[model samples]
Target: MTDKSIYRIVFHNQGNIYELYAREISQSAMYAFVEVSDIIFGERSKVVVDPSDEKLKAEFSGVKRTYVPLHAVVRIDEVEKEGRAKILPGGEQKGNVAAFPMPLKPPID
Candidate 1:
């Protein structure tokens, strides 16, 4: 891959869809988590004021590396160019989308 290669990572977080771009993506030492580094953000002057993007920026600010649970990851794609990173609110019309259901436990005596 070239130095300018960008990777788009889409994941589900607390009922929201998070789309982000990074320079590097790799398996993390922490079990079951994917490591994302070198997050890419467009130039502040050229970018519009997007609440979703702003929220994401604040959430990831000062973070050098982030570990996302494998189960939460929706997709990962390597593209020739990077796009604006934003969050999509999970509204009532989520449609056929469903999170991986966790197994229930039996009642303890």
Candidate 2:
């Protein structure tokens, strides 16, 4: 990836869908996790503010890096420009799309 690449990471968190924009993303050293860093947020000087964006900014503030379980990650995309980071209720998903079940541990065990 180029230095200018911006990543859009979508993940499932406690029945909510989190959409975030970041300058960096990679496989985490931790087992079965994806590392996200350099989170991007809109300028605070704007008169119009999105509540969801504010919530997300507060949630991730002071966090240098974050790891999302591989199973919880919905999708990751490389976009030319950053978008507003927000959270959506998971139950609001349209159509028949469903998250694939992932076993927590070895079934034989």
Candidate 2 CA-lDDT value: 0.88
What TM-score number comes out for model 1? 0.81
Off by over 4 Å in 2: 92-97, 102-109
Specify the poorest-scoring 10-residue window by lDDT in model 2.
98-107
Q: lDDT per residue, candidate 2, 1-109, as tens digits?
A: 6779999999988777899999999999999999999999988999998999999988999999999999989899999999889999866447788567422332565
In candidate 1, stretches whose alpha carbon ends up further than 4 angstroms from where it belongs are 93-109
Show the colliding residue pairs in model 1.
none
